[model samples]
Structure formats: structure tokens, C-alpha cells
Target: MKLTTSKGARALVLVALVATVGACGLPRSGPNKREIFAGSVLKQGDAYVVTVNSRVTRATAVMPAFGFGSSFRNAGVVGSDTINAGDLLALTVFENVKDDPLLGNTGQRVSLLDQVQVDGQGYIFVPYAGKVKAAGQTPDGLRQILTKKLDSQTPDPQITVQRLAGDGQTVSVSGAVTGQGVYPIERPTRTLSTMLAKSGGIAIEPAVAIVRVTRGGQTGKVWLQDLYENPGLDIALRGGDQIVVERDQRAFTALGATGAQSLVPFESQTLSAIEAIAQVGGLATSLADPTGVFVFRNEPAEIANSVLGRKDLRGDQRMVYVLDLTQPTGMFEARDFLIRDGDTVYVTEAPFVQWTKTIGAITGTAGAADSLASVGSSGG
Candidate 1:
């Protein structure tokens, strides 16, 4: 009777646990493959599900273009010697007069005029020249004008004009650079690379740094490393240009059965799907289904149309792409496929994992029942 009662009690506990586990469902990182597929657009779901292949990889491999436009690329380097309004000129006049000099005393042969500011009208005031045009003229050009004007007053007047500091042709540099401030475009800092060097180089890693230049209403961007590798991408720096150096903010979320379920940043300018998985520590080996890998993103309408081979989709559409790593070309496809910003990389648990959980739960409950039955019998 005792043996039969113990067996019955264990069977009852096992049945109760099976029902409870079935009703409550096993804890999972995310939905299974079937649940994910059922949510596809073909099944009245919000997202469009597509299997990744060579065609799909090619269609979706496009990354954000980051190079200067024609206007920026074609822009010529500005001459540092050219003078403009808002520039401060330092002028020194050498008088050859013997007794009484018009601009200087007998002993004072050289008259130092410092901080001679150019006005908005592009003119500078000299002792005798009286509002001489300085803008659009180099230092030597301005010196000739000053000498010519003072020639009549004094026997021989030799004047020299030097640009002390320029406030007119300057570029403001900020963000992720060692030095951030407004810098004048001088001979050493006339181009993009030179300007970045003047600002103490980029503070972030060269592999992930982005340089953005905004001129007037238009903005152009380039990878910091690419700017050096490709000569064509190193554009000239114009006056009033705003240069910003920053770390690449693009990242993706690693969820489901990935080794690490967290946000992972792009290690390089362009990131592949396989590279992204590697960055997040790869898939959870014990629980992950090698065949059930997915990438979820809101793809643009054009890419979506191309990927699905359907023109009906308009605007940004939710998309879920599947990758069966068990296939021959699956690893190659993943290597070629690009992962965009805000994408979710997920790996579903193997089907057998849930069954294993069920078995474990049942055995645990049966063991507890056996222990209770043994205790009750001993007490009686």
C-alpha cells in the first residue's frame, strides 16, 4: 500500500508540474522562430519577414555615404596672405626727413602703428593715406599703397604692413578634438587635415572618429581615417566653416540568445552582421539555435522594395531578416549583410531547450513529492 501510495503521489506531482509549466510557459529571452515567422506581414503581422540571401545581402549592404559633395570637394584652398575686413594690421613707417618729419620727430625715424583695424568698408586708416582700401589686398599690396600716399609729405617714406591677427577668415572647431576653438586659416592650416592638426588632432579613436564640416547651409562628412587615406576626401577649409570631430554614435541592440544582451557600438565606420554578432560576444552556445538568427530593423522604403522585390511598400517599414547558419552560404551571407543603426540582432533558443526545461521542472517536482512522502511515512 505504501509503495503504491508513493508512486501515485509522485505521478500526481509530475502531472501538476507539467500542466503548470505548459500554462505559464518557460522563460525565454525572446520569441521562438515560429512566433517570429507568424508575426510576418504575410501572416497579418506588422513586420515583413525576409530570408537573407545573396540578392538580399547585396540590396541591403548599402551604408550611409560620408564624403564631401562637389561644392566642398571643388572648393580651393584659401590664401592665408590675403587680407580681409576685421583683420588687424601692424604698420611701421620709416621717415627719411632730416629736420622736421611730418609723421615722426627728427630722432624718431620709425613710427610704429600697432592695432590698425580694418573697418567693415574694407578700409584701414593710416596717418596720411586716410581710409585706404586694405581688404582684398595682401600685406605687401597695402604697404605699397601706404608708401605711395606718404611719399609727397616726406622725402622718402618706406612703410611695411603686417597682418597681426585675422578675425575675418576663421573656422570654428569643436567636439572630440584635443583643442576646440575658432582658428584662423593660416598657411599651415589651410586644408582639412591641417586644420584638424591645428586643433590638436581628434580625441577619439581614429577608426571610429567622424569629421563633419558645415559650410553655409550645406554639411559634408567623412571618416577621420579616410580623410588621410583618400586624398580626394581631404577637402579645403573655407572661412566661416564649422568643423566638428566626434565619435560614431551608430550602434545596435544585441538581444535574445546572444552571449551579451546589451547595446553594442560600431567598431568601425561600416559594420557587417557577422561582425556585430562577434562584437556582442557571439551567440549563447548552449541555448542559441544556430539556424535561427534574425536582424530586426525599420528599413527605408527603397531598400525594402528592392529586398522584397515588391514596389507596394512605401515609407519606412518594419523588417525582420532571418539567417539560417546551418546552410552552406549562411555564414557568407551574414558576413556580407550590413547591420544598420538601431537594429536588433537576435538568436532564438533551440527547440529542444524548452523541452529540457520541462523535463527539469518535472523531475524537480517529483523529487520534492518523494521527499514529502518519505517524511510522512516515517512520522506515521
Candidate 2:
């Protein structure tokens, strides 16, 4: 069949072709306002479409609570001055008898014993003083015990016990820190914050930094900032404790007509909807529909019930929260609305965008048809 080149026939064909394109639907970032409204629970879709309001903001304003529990908080600071098994002690014995010194040579009144390790059974052996319990005792306490033990062997023997920094009473600091090593628990580094400092402090941002402490079989985690803000969270360090500092792994997905589509990490302890939008450089100005900003999340049963005002919902519920920035209170509602990990913030394209795209398609088609008509007329 010969192709029609007449202007009248071409106009009719262009109208039909445009109609087909319109019926098939034009390209869009995501669902429009009407399509979103149609997907509400009241409609055929399973998602609950809620308009952002003060109530919805409060219902979803929950934040992650990262801190120590009662067990960790109740623990007292470890005594840095106290002696423990595996610790090295330096002992000095001073005797008044110069002629017959038991521990020292003749004319020598002082005897020094270096690197006296406390045994696993918490006992330390001294020459002529025998075995004495040293793990639970302080340096001064051990000295008094040694003085009494050696009084029978030496006349008025004075003893001094000094605790040395060793592997015992130490914590292993690792992960996101300026320095990662085994640090001794001293008077200044007996607590969580002080120990972190002794390791050259946290290497990550304080806002997103998490401090995890594992003592024995139990482990506790708290935000690095909270560790200082809340005194109770800064628990004392213990022997054989493992400390790790790391960044929060929570993030959300940005899709549709936002400035950029990617996984955005939580930059602060708490994130609001507006802040999240800003983190992605806000919406695409030319294509975004201010009235069609949506947040997609699968809320827990408890939060879903609170949001929908119905207790019948169980398990995770798919929810789409709509924000109309054109309204007077829309900006405020978005400001108060909190974003959670794994949420998807989507901004639909303006309704006019599809129409403009359709127009461009129609014009391009017309231009091609006119060129074909000109070529056919020339051939005839």
C-alpha cells in the first residue's frame, strides 16, 4: 500500500497515533497522585495510603534507642589500683639488720624483687614470706601482708609492693578507632570514654559512631555521643573486655524524581523526612510534583496499628505516606515526619511532564511524516 502524503490524511493519522501513545501511557518516575490514591487500602491495593499530618508524624517519629542495659549500667568502674592475677608486681624489702640480712647481701639493707607475677590462683610467693593472696588486694594491702609475713624471718622488715602495667586488667580496643591495641586499665583509662581516648579516640564521625563493649558472655552497645551524654551508659571497663567502635549501618533508599537515586546512610542519630530529602539534594525541581512526595515503608504491626487506628493488622504492613508541600502545614509535617532504615523516599513527576512528553512525541512524529511527504511528492 502506498503511504499517504496529503496534509489532511497525515493530520488524521497523527491524531490516531497520538491517541494510541496516550492510551499506552507516557513515561514517569513513579506512580502519580491519582494512581497512589487508587492503591489505598480502601481501594484494590494492599498498601495504606496516609496523608502526612501531626498524628502520622507522631506515630512514626520513633527512633532507634542504642544504649546500655541495666546490667551494664549498674557495673561499677574497675579499680585501676587493685591487683589481679597475671599482673606483674615489683617488691622491695628494707631490713634494719645490716650484718645478717636475710634477703639482701651483707651491708646491703635493701632487696629488690622485679617481675613478681601473680599466679592464676591469685597467689604471689615471696622468699621467706611464703604464698600470699594478691589478686584481690591492693599494692599497699599486699605490702602490709608481706611485712607481717617476713617479720618472723627478718627483724623489722619493711616491704613495698608496686603494681606494674601488664597484660592483666587490660581491654582490647579495635574497629573504627585511631589506635587499635590492648590498652591497660589505669586510673585515667578505667571507664569506656577514657579507654577510647587512650586508644586515640574514635575515627568515625561522633554523630554516627557506635561503641560496642563485650564483657564475658554479654555485650552492650551505645552511641558514642550518648556514652558521654548519659553518664550511666559510660560503663566501667573490665578485664578481658573487648571494645569496638564503628559507624551506624542504617540507611534508606532514594528513588523516583529525587535529586539522586541511591542508598543514603543515616548522617545523624535521628533523621526527619525533610532532612532525608535534603541529604539527596532535594527533589528534581523541573520534574518533581511537590504534592506527590511519598515515603514507602513496611511498618511493624504495632506502628501500623497506631497509624491506621485499627488493631486488626498483624505482621509488617506496607504503608505509603503522602506529603503535599503545597499546603500551609505540609512543610511542617514533613519536618516532623521521621524516616526509618530501609524506607524508600519517592517523588513523582509533575502531571504536566507526561503531557509535555506526549507533545514532544507527537511533534517528532509529525516532522518525520512531513519529510516523507516532501520526498514522495518529489518522486511523483
Candidate 3:
């Protein structure tokens, strides 16, 4: 019985060995060596060029009126010597006015009125007409006031008042518009858009793209885009008001195991980790080791010294973040983690996978050789 049992055991062992050898000889179902090789080469790195949508919001284009003919009409205080301040006036009192020698034949050029400056004050400086305040008064208004003042001294004293330089008017233009400098307030009805066009419009790619008006120390942000949407928003600009155009500076980068890795432009001003991942075409399913996904960033040396020595990092030396996505929640954190410019992302390959593939290849080759030998023997 022992001999029979041992023979049976030997036979069983032989059968098991034969089954193992036959199984090895059969073609494997998964991707072939050539296919895997091709896949490995093709999927090795991320694509260099990637398409990103532009952030600028498109609006309806409107044809603006062009040429000097469309320019604003010159009105309100046009002449250079129209009016000014601090000029002496002459108030002349003609006794027997019609018979006065100064009123000779023609009364047009007669010295009928005279006023003069006194005590450094803006008043008609007359011989006996002390200081009369003419600061806030216009030419006509000053004329009347001087007439009253001289009349008090001498009844019906003809008076004329002219300004030296009209209160030094000026307008300030600033913000995103070009040529941000003070412009002379030539007209009181200058439109905001006209001034902007004169100053070469707003800077390109402004952060805010909205012009802010600061007048009398009050601030307000106005959308330049709105001007096209609603024409009324392009109101007339006033003196001492500033127009500021804010610049936009929000961006993110895509790297690592994605199909296309590039700097993706975002206008939302804030880039979420999830959005960034989608921007780069997501991770490679077959090759990417989801567990080994990592983002490298700079941190303070003092804080990182506990986990990694200061010598590990170079210059302005700092910390390095090592993230392992093996845990289920790690992916969630990665989705939440904000990516900045110049950030490096790495996706590692699965461990021991290459070894298994190598062994499988060796076994396949041995099986093919054995099968060929068996066929040769049969043919012989």
C-alpha cells in the first residue's frame, strides 16, 4: 500500500508540474511586450503644449466716432485772456461826466473807471479806494462791487475789474489709463471716454479692467466693460478726479502625469486645486501611481528642520512638502491644495510592477522555446 501511495503521489506531482509548464506556455492575456513598451514610451512624460481658454470676457464691439470732426466742441471760457485773478482795476470819477476833459470827443476810450490792488489783497487798487476783497467775485461781479465801494467814497464812481489769471484751474487724471498726469482744465464738459482716448486708453491686461474714480477723496470702481454694455456709464469727467485701472495677476501651472503640462491662465482670480487638475487633462490611469502623487513647494527652514535637515535645501533655504496620495483622503487634500506658479508635481510608478513584468517575460520566452522544441521533435 505504501509503494502504491508513493507512486500515486509522484504521478500527482508530475501532473501538477506539467500543468504549470503548460500554463506558462499559453499566451498571456494582458498587453503584450511590444504594446507595453510602446505604451510606456508614449505615456512616459506629459505633453509640452496645452491649450487654455483666454480669460478676457468677450463683449459686443462698438464703432467709436473717429477724426477731429467728432472731437468735442470748444466751449465755455475759450479765450486765453478771458478771465483771471489778482489784477489791479482803475475806478475813475468823471466830474461833470459829459463835460469831462478825459471824456473828450469819443466816450468809448474815455478813462471812465479805475481800480487798483492794495495791501497784497485781490481788490481794485484805487488812489483812495482802500482794500476791497475780490477773490471769489467774477469780472462783472467785481465790477459791481468796486462800483459800490468807490461810490461809498465818491458817488457814481465808474469802476472796471479784470482778473490777472483765473484761479489756476487744473484736472488730475490717473489709474489704468495711459499718460497718467495732470491736464489743464480747458473745458468743464470733458467726457471720461474722450480723456481716456486722449491719454491712450487704459493699460493692456489690467487686473481689475475697471476704472476707479477718486474725486474729492471718495473712491468708486467702474467697469470699463460696462461702458460698452451701458453707454451712460461713460460720464463726463470732472476736475480733481482720478481714473485708476487695476491690473489682474492671478494664475496657476499644470505639471506631472497629466497629458499636457503648462501654465493655465485663469481669470477667476482664484485657482482651486480641483480646477487645476482638470486643466492639465487629469492623471494617467494605467501608469500613474495615485498613491505616490506629490507636490513640491518651498517652506521655512526652521519649520522643516525637524523633518528634514537645512542642508537638504539650497539657498535662501526652506522646507519641502512631501505628499503621499496612498490614503483615500490624500486625494481630497490634493484637490483642495492651491497650486502656485513654478510648482513641481511628481507621479511615481507602482513598486514591484517592473519585477513582475520581467519575470513574466522570462517565463514567456522559456515557454515559447520549450513549445518550439516539442514541435521540432514531433516533426522529426
lDDT (CA) per prediction: 0.89, 0.88, 0.47
Candidates 2 and 3: which is better by lDDT?
2
Angstrom error at residue 306, model 3: 42
- Tell me each candidate's TM-score: 0.93, 0.94, 0.35
Off by over 4 Å in 2: 1-20
RMSD of model 2 against the true structure: 2.3
Pairs in clash, predicted candidate 2: none
Q: How accurate is candidate 3 locally (lDDT)?
A: 0.47
Worst 10 residues of 1 by lDDT: 371-380
Per-residue lDDT of model 3, residues 1-380, tens digit only: 55555455545554555567546643322222233233331356211111111110011011122111111122223333333343344444443344433333444334544334422343444445556665546567766765665565444656545543323334566766778776643343256666677677787654236666665655655556655566555655544567666654434555545555666665433444455666677666644556555444443343233233234543333222334455656555555555555455544444445556556665665565555545544554
lDDT of 1 at 49: 92
Q: Which candidate tops lDDT?
A: 1
lDDT of 2 by residue, 28-103 (tens): 7777888888988899889999998999898888888777777778878877779998999999999989697999
- lDDT at residue 145 of model 3 (Cα atoms): 65
